[model samples]
Target: RAAATSRRLSHSQYASTTSGGPLQEAFAKGALKPGLNVVLEGRPKQPNDVEGLKQCLAEFRQQLAWVERLDVTLGQLTNVVESVSQNTTDKDAVDPENDFQREMSFYRQAQAAVLEALPRLRKLKVPTRRPDDYFAEMAKSDQQMQKIRQKLKSKQEAMEKSEKAKQLRAMRKYGKKVRRSYKRDISMTRMWSLSEELRN
Candidate 1:
């Protein structure tokens, strides 16, 4: 559950300005400088350090490459899950052993990818205030989740109401049939005419 929560946070937090605050601060404070699109550390008033920048860029580039690869891996896993869902819908379908093995392999790869990327990201020496920033992000996420839950609850209620109406109609139809089977008070022709009139 914690792993799932972290993955959700990683994805959700990616688009926010706060996502790279620590990294951004390193650059802003002259602890890390951008040298031709690469990152390097230097004295506050010093010129660009090309070699240090290249090394930092190499590490950052590798991390981004890993992230991209992980995304592709995730997409493949999603496809496999979608296929599994489709097969499960067929009453007679059975899951093969190899499919499960492949799914496990995909999950392991994704987990490994995330673990590898995290270390490289951390190596930037970026400092961040924990608990405070984290708590604020959690509050925002919770609010969004609450709104989603409310929408889902209302939709479920509507569906339940619709299903109840269908069941009531079925029960009424069955009741009429049962009564007709026991005794015939209205003639069939007149009953058909009455039903037509009611429908109109």
Candidate 2:
């Protein structure tokens, strides 16, 4: 029950508080440590999985504009979660596949906000050393990202098509109304001209 409530509050905070500037700045400045945290390491691997830790070194380079990359990373994280949901077999799963899904989602959202705050962290000149197992860790993250993306492809494309169809329908409806109004105006103008000629 508490977890569910926490999840709800996280959702509220995510859509509002952490979506803006100061919290992001704190992350960039590496100042707020007692607040929100999103730790994904040490998660139990799936039976078929071979990788060990997820997400490696987001090296905050001093001169680099890390914000854009961070934004992309967040988007990618969202895609990962979506792909997992689309591909999972929830019915036959061990505690049900949807179990922990909410928590994982909250994690990614929080991580995204924290990452957006990376600029201030960079500004603070936080010295972060690359992990000894950096390459392996990165390979794991890459593999997961790719796996999710591949799984996501078909569903994502279908969703895009649906969205496009809706947009097209709306546009066509608006266009039809505009065309009717335009035709009426043109006819009115012609009738006015004819009346003036008749009067002359």
Candidate 3:
């Protein structure tokens, strides 16, 4: 009997909490439903960080000023694909396999960019060409270059030697053939002279 009484009290406590808690208030206001599986929309919006935003804006302005001072920003280049599509009526002009038209469009765009950039760069006094006194370091060391050169020279020499040996062998074979023919001609002459004497 005591166990039954305690179980009833626990059930009543759980019922009270479920009925009078914040969830019940939400359900009463139609913000929550009993059986529907849906996301709640009554949550408050996140507060913005005003100080953090100000800091970010300040940093962006500094970066913009630096870029302006350097005058490195070329703004935006014209879209080659879009321009090609607009200028040409052929359906294949924009196709990737149509390399000629695509390449020509890119070339024209690059040319235009160079033409536009040169004047601006000149006005800003930016150096467009490398100085004559500037010297670039070679990618390969001098010793490595020398080894490559030696290897190429040895290979060429071997090729030339092989060609000369081939020519000599061919000449020797031709000389042997010539000598055999001359010997045959002498023997035939001798036999013919003997036969003529016998007939006389």
Global Cα RMSD, each model: 23.2, 27.6, 14.1
Candidate 3 lowest-lDDT run of ten: 66-75
Q: Compared with the true structure, what per-residue lDDT tens digits does model 3 show for residues 1-200?
A: 99999999998898877745666667767777556433466897998999999998988865454326644334334465555666656533466676875687667767776787778778868888999999899999999999999999999999999999999999999999999998998899999999999999
Candidate 1 weakest lDDT stretch, 10 residues:
67-76
Please rank every candidate by lDDT, starting with the best: 3, 2, 1
Native-referenced Cα lDDT, model 3? 0.75
lDDT of 1 at 158: 99
Residue-pair clashes per candidate, as listed?
0, 5, 0
lDDT of 1 by residue, 106-189 (tens): 676677666665665577543433675363445457779999999999999999999999999999999989899756655776
Question: Where does model 2 exceed 4 Å of error?
Answer: 1-148
Model 2 error, position 58 (Å)? 45
- Candidate 1: where is the Cα deviation over 4 Å? 1-105, 108-136, 139-143, 184-200
TM-score of 3: 0.37
Q: Specify the highest-TM-score model's number.
A: 3
**Which candidate comes out best when scored by lDDT?**
3
User: Roughly what TM-score does model 1 have, to 2 decimal places?
Assistant: 0.30
